[model samples]
Target: MESLTIRRPDDWHLHLRDGDMLRAVAPESRDMGRAIVMPNLVPPVVTHDDARAYRERIVAAGFARPLMTLYLTEGTNPDDVVSAHAAGTITAVKLYPAGATTNSASGVRSIEAVRAVLAAMEAAGVPLCLHGEVTDREIDIFDREARFLDDVLTPLRAAHPELKLTLEHVTTSEAVDWVRAHPGVGATITVQHLLANRNDMLAGGLRPHFYCLPILKRGRHQEALRAAATSGESAFFLGTDSAPHPTHAKEATCCAAGCFTAPIALACYAHVFEEEDALDRLESFASLNGPAHYGLPPNADTVTLTRGAALDLPPRIDTHGQSVTLFDPGHPLHWHIH
Candidate 1:
């Protein structure tokens, strides 16, 4: 098929940083209709008022409707979360195990420490979006996610059965299995992980841009993620986790972890689904499932994607004084959204 049309999709997870970075990247996601904006800023968005201000900035940057999330820290006030959700200023509360990723110094150090906030979110019908990785020094970096599933996530879920949970940018087969087995729980998959693996990072030399938290796994894990993403499972949907770092930050002595792909996210998804021979299921995965999980309606408009011709995406995006590199899928992408 040369062309395909589907409901306009929402990015279940995205990161448009503050200031010039936000201004530069927010516009790239305009076609995504809506996005659950991550709250891992410098100070982080931790309250209803903070989210409101951030939302205003996003609107100022030309993002039509950006869904907000509050960073879940140990000190996060339960009442604040309830108020934010009730007021509709934020859609969810994001949990980042301290030091899990960029701008996460204030993330929760222990699940027990944030029980009050979690309880409040549960009572308020607010979803909990997780980074899904652990920072235990004993655990190998690549093994953090699977270990987190066993060590933290399992117990957290058991304790808060009522809390709606979404494992964001899940990168392991173990995550796919657990999410699939649990009904009502959801997860988001990034296009970068769908196209690349750990080899892409270390196979030749260090490819810093390919490095991301819950670092990309091996081939089997990649296959599992691919299957879970294209299987048309409601538990799995789209989350670009399109984190951007300055060119210097990404190419430094110790590089920050993230892949900026907001510019070509849809095309990447189309390529993944089409390669899996599940093009018919793309709409459900990209558009319908996310809104259903979020208790929102799918977008009324549609986006048409054309295949049979390669779309030449720019290798990098200039955002203010810094430049962010775009993810290279390492294959010809024959799909383009129109």
Candidate 2:
């Protein structure tokens, strides 16, 4: 098909850092009708007031209608969490296993320590977005997400059955199966995970931009993620964990963990769906499943994508006195959103 149109999609997970970087990248996600803006800022958005202020700044940066969230920490107050959700200041609370990703030093060190907050969120009908990976040094990095499912998420699900949970950026077949087996649970699949695997990051040499938390997995996992994303299942949706770092940071000794794909994510997803021969399901994965999981409605408007000549966009965007590199999906993308 040369052209396709669907409801404007929401990014189920996104990261817009504070200040200059936020300004530089926020506009990149403008087409998303709404986005569940991540709260992993330095010091983190830990309270309702913090989320409110951050949301204001994000709007000021140009991407409006961001559904804000709080960064879950060990000392988080349950009342603060519950009240924030009830007051509509925050949509959900993010749980990051300590040291799991960038700016996550203050993330939860122990799930037990945040039980009160979790219980309060569950009781109040607030959702929980999880960075599903275990930080135990003994567990191989590749095994973390799978281990988290078995050792952390399973029990947590059992303990708080009503707590709405979204497993953010899932990268494994096991994760796909787990979310499928459990109804009402949702998972967000990132563009990088769908387009590239660990081999793309490590095969020839280190390609830092492809490196992300719950780091890219083997090809089998990549296949699994693509299948799940293109399956039109309600449990899976789009979350471009489109993290950005200055070009210098990404090319340095310890590269940053993310892909700066916010500028090109939708077109990339179209390419993935087309490759899977499931363009018919693009609207469901990109625009429908997310809202259903979050108890919202689909966007009324739409964006049309046309398959055409290879996209000739720049490989990087200048921002913050430096530049952020956009993800290069290896193959030339023949799609553009109009």
Please tell me which predicted candidate would have the highest lDDT against the true structure.
2
Q: After superposition, how far is residue 115 of candidate 1 from its true place, in Å?
A: 0.7
Error of 2 at 190 (Å): 0.5
For candidate 2, which ten residues in a row score worst on lDDT? Answer: 315-324
TM-scores vs. true structure, each candidate: 0.98, 0.99
Backbone clash tally (model 1) = 0
Candidate 1 matches the true fold with a TM-score of 0.98
TM-score of 2: 0.99
Model 2 over residues 276-307: C-alpha lDDT tens digits? 99999999999999999999989999999999
**Model 2 Cα shift for residue 210 (angstroms):** 0.8
Q: List the residue pairs that clash in candidate 1.
A: none
Question: Which residue ranges in model 1 land beyond 4 Å of their true spot?
Answer: none
Residues 1-338, model 1: lDDT tens digits: 67899999999999999899888888999669999999999889998899999999999987989999999988888998898899989999999999989999999998888998888888889999999999989899989999999999899899999899999998999999989877889999998899999998889798888889889999999999999999988898999999988878888999988998898889999988888999999999999999999999999999999886677778878857658888787778888787
lDDT of each: 0.90, 0.93
* Candidate 2 residue pairs in clash (backbone atoms < 3 Å): none
